[model samples]
Target: MSFTSARPEDLLIDAARRGDVPYLQQLLADGTVDVNVQNGKGFTALIVAAYDDQVEATKALLAAGADPNVQDVSGNSALMGVSFKGYPEVARLLIQHGADLNQQNGNGGTALMFATLFGRHNIVPILLEAGADTTIRDVRGLSARDLAVQQGNEEALKLLPQE
Candidate 1:
């Protein structure tokens, strides 16, 4: 069956979470399912795919014109979700697709900060090279560097700007 706006957003989101690229493409083929369509939790297919590290699915959603910067109820974007989860491949895809590197959540936490706090060393440099602002502080006044220090993330600390 062809998709319509009436199609359940969760179906598409679930497909993304599951890394079901074929089903996702099928749903998007009709161009009816908005790639940015959010479920009750405010997760779009792109967000789900990125958070779950479904590189192919993420690519499909972006190709389908998903808004990479769209944030969830907590103001977490696809980039931030991937960062927090330590999905470097997904982070790279999101970055290459023009996701905002400095977009913060409701707590003012940037992707870099999450990567730092979570000890996602692999993603820290990727985000920095992509121009994520290390100066931006969270609501608690912690920058990515500070978070790195607080979390004792030596790997991230070494890669972070000394400023």
Candidate 2:
């Protein structure tokens, strides 16, 4: 569909995904677009930005009052999305914006679990410092530490507390 036919919220999400900071800024400044508006997948602009590693877009969305804890259709939050992608800075920004560190996804996986499963070593510490519950287990009954060990993520395993 043409840009004219697209919803303003869709345009905002597209700006976030493309890292078009200027366009995003304009959208946010317009004050009509819902920063927390979800797409078909239930992913809000902040989630899209974080998932795409669009740091500036993420910052703009958060500043626009996007709820960082809003989850997608699969139950993945912005923090989890960024963590799974190994984008520590974006994860950090999400956390700072009130993203739940221990929020479990559809698979019962938290951002910490995603970080461990993906060997996102840099993200592990940030989640930890943000008060991620290491004791939490996923659908497979695996904690972050267990996943680290299972995935042979040596760096993550080292950072995890000894069980």
Candidate 3:
């Protein structure tokens, strides 16, 4: 990504942010815009769409061959973003698109950790069912269940596997 503000990548990012499917498809068809092009923050269109809860845009991006496992500068994948945001549908989309359920971020936080820490109970099961490892610990030596316990997220705690 260059410093140019008017670049097609910028437009693509904005289009995904707004869930503008037609415009997104048009840009993808132009062949100049890389579907995985990242902004200054290393956020691709797919990451933006999934984080913003744009289900259709996310699906379109996946259909266009977006890498669901692409991480941001912080090593946060689209799955982690949606898990924290409580977008269950978006989470499922990424999972179906081959998102790594247990991929950790720079902080060693997985999607399950984010979901549990953020009170996204719905995402916890989705991740667990997809085979997320509860034993994975973050930089703080906290697992998803530990986060749920700290956050007092009873729903998440109940859903989590016993240690």
lDDT by residue (107-155, candidate 2, tens digit) is 9999999989998888999999888899998898889999988898999
TM-score top scorer: 3
Local accuracy by lDDT, each model:
0.88, 0.88, 0.94
Error of 2 at 4 (Å): 8.0
Candidate 2 Cα outliers beyond 4 Å, as residue runs: 1-5
lDDT agreement of model 1 with the native: 0.88
lDDT of 3 by residue, 1-163 (tens): 6564678999999999999999999999999999999999999999999999999999999999999999999999999999989999999999998999989899999999999999987888999899999999999999999999899999998999888
Candidate 2 CA-lDDT value: 0.88
Clashes of each: 0, 0, 0
> TM-scores of all models?
0.92, 0.93, 0.96
Estimate the Cα RMSD of every predicted model relative to the unseen true structure.
3.6, 1.7, 2.6
TM-score, candidate 3, is 0.96
Candidate 1 Cα errors over 4 Å, as ranges: 1-6
